[model samples]
Target: MNSKSELIKFEEGISLESGDNLSSFELMIETYGDLNDSKTNAVLVCHAFSGNHHVAGKKSNGEIGWWDEIVGPNKAIDTNKYFVVCCNNLGGCSGSSGPSSINPTTGKIYGKDFPIVSVKDWVNSQNMLTERLGIPRWLFVVGGSLGGMQALEWSIAYPEKILKAGIFAAAAKSSTQNIAMNEVGRESIRKDPNFNNGDYIELGVKPKNGLKTARMLGHITYLSEENMDLRFGRKFQDSNSKVDGKVDFEVENYLQYKGEKFTENFDANSYILMTKAMDGYDASKNFKNLDEALSSVSSELLIVGFDSDWLYPPERGKEIQLAAMNNNIRSSYITLDGRQGHDSFLFASEKYEEIIQDFVGS
Candidate 1:
């Protein structure tokens, strides 16, 4: 993939959905391929909650992107044919303006004082970036999970700016169960003594334990019970290391490893902010019904769901498709057979890839 990561500064600043205005801010973005003369071949790839702008390249640190499997030269996204752009969201911890960033006015980290950003805010910021890059419209806006939420929002908020969208394992709004799980994760972070009320940065400390616990809990929802059973299956991480009549299961070890790895790359405050954004997301909020809300979308839609995704579920993807179709929007829905649950979209399944290749290539 011919790609490079760069930072874009918004000199005119951006106003948040919460009525706050940032005097200046920066967004880290990664781009692949060259924009056509008309600049219409641009594809915007939105990342999941914990993901970053490094969507399809080997970074200077030698780390590959989270979605490298789906976005290289001959991959589903096909960088050789389309100019792909992915940005670190404004409230992201990964080289973007967020709670960890120093406040221009206060000369200290924004921390908890950072205004709560919603999915709409993120969309607006992305639009600004697109305009900055001289792109008139996106050929496709694609994402999975929280990224999918942003794709849906892009269609609703800026219909004229995109030709089509691909939303995978996402919903029109946060379900009750989803909100409950997010709340639990938030509680885990808040209860940690090192959290320091989200001001840990000033104290020269990080709420590592809290963030680890939150990631560990959230990870469970990303995979299906079937997957967990088939992969871990009551196996012990170390059969010889039993303590207090209990042995550590392989699953426990896996979760711990994931949690530790996540904490090493993510910020606790950003996690809270992202979950809040997810909880507050509702595409139909101001409309009478979902169909009415989606009536304004001009883009063709492709919604993909995993049969075993209990978190977002196949029914949710169907709801999005139905709403779009009822409103006379061109739309399609597909439920791929997979036991990986919500994270199935990230895997390199040939079926899933073929579906995307066909949709975008067509």
Candidate 2:
């Protein structure tokens, strides 16, 4: 086992009970600015699945973060004022533990055998990180998409420890439609002959084709038809449409780019497991009911949704807002015009950023 120091220098591995025999792990973190004696200015930013702890600029490989536009010294997550800590989720394939990590007994990668997890399990991990990093209380927790799910979980799980929460382009629970989409991607991986029951790594032949197909499919869902029309349209990339001289459509080219780029670093097994966990998120069942669950969330909230996010439409976010209101928890909801659909939050929408900045400033 590698010591905490070699694991990229944050608070490192901190374990917690996640109701299973397996001890769910967390990657503790720290950021710029001193935590006052009161420790109120700390902000915890939860990442979407497939996102790493890197939330700002380029990595050592010169790859910038997905949220680079909103997280920086003076950006929405402003390291200049409040300290920020962003963690990889419990089932993530990042610096923290996951299926890719080696199993102690078998001494091989866990692969498809990683334990299932939940939003509560994820929050429990972050709580360990918060404690290890000496952040007794958080000024706010901010995130979007799956990250936003974690943000909502933070408020419910540690109501007394957080002052406010920002949930953008997300649902209180993962939608069935979203689950079906993710399941289709997972099944694509499983159906690949190269998968070999998740032990294909030993064969030196990854299920690249099936995974690419899945990525291509997922890329389609992340975009709205309107956004696709504005960006890709029916224009041909190869400018050929006779007896199929070459592939046509700019949208096809865009999807190919997305798929090819995804397989470079992503693992199919990790994708499957994380999507499973996300699909299991059931906000209503956790408490007496949905309203009761929202009542348990005592922190102030900022909920933002895109006009075109059909995956978890703005109406879904309105239900969350109404839940918060019914419970009388401090909450605000905003909708931004975005044709890019659910992915607008990731693509750096100007209106999105402005609202996030306004909330962060609060």
Candidate 3:
């Protein structure tokens, strides 16, 4: 599938759940396939942290989308059968209004002044976009990790708008450990000399080292110990002359490359804001409890967990399932046996793709 990204501006800005309002904003979105006459065949795919509107297919620049493996023609999500819509979240740096965007009021970058946006805010913004697109209801709303949390939110917050919800490798809220990890990443960026109080762009410098370290730490959490051992296993980078106290591990080299690559494209302020948003999201807080929160959900749910994903873990997914069951909501839980850790949902595998295909097909 060949896809093009479109930026749609909304003059009637959204009043966020936090009570802050943007006078105007734009959303970068990419769509695949075609909408049926009734617009009932729409499927919404929410992006996780660090993800943008490019979900699948190839851009004119020849760059393949992040989940191209599972979202093209005849693929898991099957763009050929359903109109797939994805957008850069409101607080994202990817062509969306965020910390990096210019503030109309001050004639400067929002930076630290950008309002704290919550998951509910994201869903609300997405809802506006949906309405603008003339989509009456979605056949499915699906995502993984932070994206999964958004999907879960949609099912509860707008139960009448979605038919099926797919939540993969996500928890209803961030655990203490997860929160701590996010805090550490935030600290790294804040402490960077170039950060300059989130004004690095104004200072004509980037927090390259800080963002690099943060991404390196995040990459570690995305993989399982078993997977790391199987792939790298303490292998040395080369047989060259040993420098005194030099780190030559192939895993270290890979992490360095990944970290460097991330710093080039991602903004430090956006990273901090996004991680904080993830940490602050607690889906059940608006209601009495998890079961109460899920009680109003009209969509059928499919929750998936990876056996090796210690980040969210299988138990977290099960907890959602238990809550949904308590409300007698139609839901299914599946734990995939994989070593890819929390990122298992992002990868395409026979079982994983098949499960999604069957769910969507049904």
Q: What is the C-alpha RMSD of each candidate to the true structure, in Å?
A: 1.8, 4.0, 1.9
- Name the runs in model 2 displaced over 4 angstroms: 1-19, 23-37, 239-246
Better of 2 and 3 by TM-score: 3
lDDT of 2 by residue, 1-362 (tens): 00011142223443333445343343533254456667778888788766767776656688777777787766766766777777766556665666667665577777777677776777877787787677888998988788888888889879988988988888988887899999899889999999988877767778887888898888887788899888877887864422233456777776777787788887877788777767877677658777988877889899989888888789878888999999988899988887888887776666777777777676
Candidate 3 lDDT over residue span 135-187, tens digit each:
98999999999999999999999999999999999999999999998888889
Clashes of 3: 0
TM-score (C-alpha) between model 1 and the true structure: 0.97
Q: lDDT, candidate 1, residue 356?
A: 94
- What C-alpha lDDT, on a 0 to 100 scale, does residue 62 get in candidate 1? 93
TM-scores for every candidate against the unseen true structure: 0.97, 0.90, 0.97
Q: Which stretches of candidate 1 lie over 4 Å from their true place?
A: 239-247
For candidate 2, give the lDDT.
Answer: 0.75
Candidate 3 Cα outliers beyond 4 Å, as residue runs: 239-246
Q: In candidate 2, which residue pairs get closer than 3 Å at backbone N, Cα or C atoms, i.e. clash? A: none
How many backbone clashes can be found in candidate 1? Answer: 0
Better TM-score candidate (1, 2)? 1
